[model samples]
Target: MSEEIRETQQQPQEQTPPPAQETFKPRPPGQRVTMKELLEAGVHFGHQKERWNPKMKKFIFTERNGIHIIDLQQTLQYFEKAYDYIADLVANGGKVLFVCTKKQGQDIVKEEAERCGMFYVNKRWLGGTLTNFQTIRKSVFKLKMLKKMEEEGVFDQLPKKEAVKLRRKKEKLEKYIGGIENMNRLPDALFIVDIVREENAVREARKAGIPIVALVDTNADPDLVDIPIPANDDAIRAIRLLTSRIADAVLEGKMRREAVKLAEGEEADFIPEEE
Candidate 1:
């Protein structure tokens, strides 16, 4: 009986129940986010060894499982530099064009950018948007005119097929330039996510002599950008964390701009008597 009891007790135990779920802890507002938070978002993770860009060798701190790891110190430093530059640009009446067309980043980019009243390209990047501005401006103008005409009941007078074609053309243009329609001139700077994926935007900005601030992964050429923040550009969480920082910086810049304008208005309001 004792031997049989020992055999039964030694039999494989049933699988243990899974661990209990943990509550989500939210980061506090206005708190200075730390490098540790950045790590939690996987910003230090990089691409495979084979895809590592030689120009980013200095930014790579180490490697694991054939993947290059970004130096968090360098990322923090570079990001601060970009943040300062963007703030100064916006405070001085400059505009920033955000380019993040990747699937994971599109919705995030649009929301963050719009929140700060900045422009973005979340859809297809229309070539020549910056380099050949005149032609693109013409199309944007036509689009606006068509919208006005529609509002005035002009489209109602057109033939059925002709109006349908016109509407389709307007939709296509909007898909390309709707976000940038309010921008009457080339952007003073461009903020790009995944420089490798949005290389066309990079090239166009370069062609137009515009400076670029980019979140560069290991697979991307960091030297191509004016300011490169080494990070995991593919992860949505990492992208969101960084872009949220940028959006905050932009909002701060806009606030400064408003303050300056208000001061100027007060100064202009004063009347000087004849001396």
Candidate 2:
């Protein structure tokens, strides 16, 4: 025992290393739109035969168990094209309107669009929203006025019943257009989750001559969209994944725009050669 203790005393003991600090490195923009991601999110699965849109027959790879299987290769190519278009659009200070009123689409689209500082419509698509933007803007203005009045104590001076009525009206308007209250004009492009479900929005966007990037499933008319990414629109996972990729592209565009502005500012402040 004494000899073992003496041997241990001659050896150096190991020391504990410091814990790693977690650093979050974001995915490089459209890099998320990969075949692995698409497959993991069930993006290749399409609608059943009974619900399939004949217009989308060209994008279908095969028929299995009465369900259509989307061609991932086609989806990848089209998605890349769409991503580049969206990136360029945002880098030029263009706006994109995300339209997805269905329950599955509402939350994901709203979250992603807001994260990228883009506008969206997650609730009911009001008729003439694009054509009669003036009327909608009026409603949004009224909402803002009421909110400002409340903040300035104007509502406190009113009758209790009148205050309640105004508050209720504001809530109603918020449900319809809160996501787009800050939108001063029509968007440069429209990104839709379910093209068929939000057909009115698509038609309005087309009427405004705005570009459209849409998730065209087997049950959706692919020709209706300007840029169609053929995928499974019904799957929540797929929608979430694709929307995230779109949002990332927007984010990258915004970053590029800021970089360009900074570079321009630097050039403007530079001292030229006297010669």
Candidate 3:
């Protein structure tokens, strides 16, 4: 079959055609995403069939020509479960770490993590970041110290050569651990973009007993993650949509947590009238 013919046959007639230029606008926290939105974001498109992993067979809807089509219905179903789990986790004072080292997803990962007020590793995933967290905490402390020194004007008073050296050191730390400077403890869970590309992160999370919620493509094993939402991991639009949804869930969870705190505080402050 011709490529154009395969594409047409794969898409549904009822689905809305993508815009001339697709721009992502994140939905509000607690808002639900629909299958039609997923379709428009191209979440159904998977890797080529030849690159498919046998373990991902259950998530594959079908093969059109040489490409695999992800089951967006399954994606939506699993995504709901993942969303609930993440929201519940955060609601109970749990923390999540976002890890997406791929060039296509680095900026999106950083933005989403910040939007949800979670720690992230977009530039690179350092070994043992989770399993060996004590060591990572030391680096985080050092980064904070450097930042404090700069804020205190210590660097300005130092010798020029010493100041230059410290500045270089601070820049390196900022690149590696800047996103995690405030992450004093290991995260309760991990949100990974591509499991295959970030295998080290998956391994470290497993070793550290942290749950993982990840976007699993056709070429990756869904079983590696605790909650795997199967989708097109290579597409920027798909990544943006999925990550934004996850961030919204986290934001919702934070709101719920604050509400609970407020209720408890109000109850504690309530005093019975004179009887």
Candidate 4:
């Protein structure tokens, strides 16, 4: 028994492995947002490795299980940069058109744009909507005419067939150009949700010399836009977060613009008109 005890004591005891090294360490909370929030929102998720754009290599942090992981640090940096740019543009009396026609983003884009009092396109992107402004304006005028007729009871007096035809035309126009009816001219900039999906809008905006700020996924080319905020463009929550941030910037800018206008008005009021 003593020999057995000595042997047991001499044998090395099984060593428990140190706690598995933590793969993800959340940074301290940030002012606008924290890395943890972004993680929870799945902003770090990217397209499959096979579908990634090579031009977006720098934005990618790594690959896990054949999926590319976006670098949230870069997302934070670029998002801030885009936010500042948009705010300054609006404050300086520049207009921004919100373009997001994807089903996942349509309602969100429309709501945010309306919240910020900016123009938006939540439906189909008509070819030459920007390039052919005169034609689009005509369509908008037609829509207004149709609405006026309806309000004035002209549709009520018309034969059923005629009224039905006119109503269908009005609905079609409203479905397509209703959002941009108030857009008198080309916007100074564009805030796009998915560049790949809204390629025509991007192309038209580029041709019209309008600067673009867009949320780019790994599958899309980031170089297409002037300011690209790398993020998960498909996730509804991610889209809401990004669009809301941009809308906030627009609202802040509008406030600044109003302040400037009020200051100008006060200064003018204080000045005496020629007696």
- Over the stretch 179-270, how does candidate 2's per-residue lDDT look in tens digits? 89999998899999988999999898888898999999999988888999999887778888899888877877787787899999999889
Candidate 4 residues lying further than 4 Å off, grouped into runs, are 1-30, 272-275
Compute the lDDT of residue 36 as modeled in candidate 3: 85
Ranking by lDDT: 3, 4, 2, 1
lDDT of candidate 4 at residue 186, scale 0 to 100: 85
Residue 16's lDDT in candidate 3: 79
Off by more than 4 A, model 2: 1-30, 271-275
lDDT (Cα, tens digit) per residue for candidate 3, span 145-179: 99899999999999999999999999999998988
For candidate 3, give the lDDT. Answer: 0.87
Order of candidates by TM-score, top first? 2, 3, 4, 1
* TM-score of every candidate: 0.84, 0.87, 0.87, 0.86
Per-model CA lDDT versus the true structure:
0.84, 0.85, 0.87, 0.85
In the range 1-275, model 1's lDDT, one tens digit per residue, is: 00011112354468753321111122333333469878987899998899888988999999998889999989988888888888789999889999999888887788788777788899989999999999889989999998888889887899999888888888888877888988899999999999999999999999899999999999999889999999999887788889978776677677778789999999988968679
Q: Against the true structure, whose lDDT is highest? A: 3
lDDT of 4: 0.85
Summing lDDT over every window of 10 consecutive residues in candidate 4, give the lowest-scoring window: 1-10
What root-mean-square deviation over C-alphas does model 2 reach? 13.0
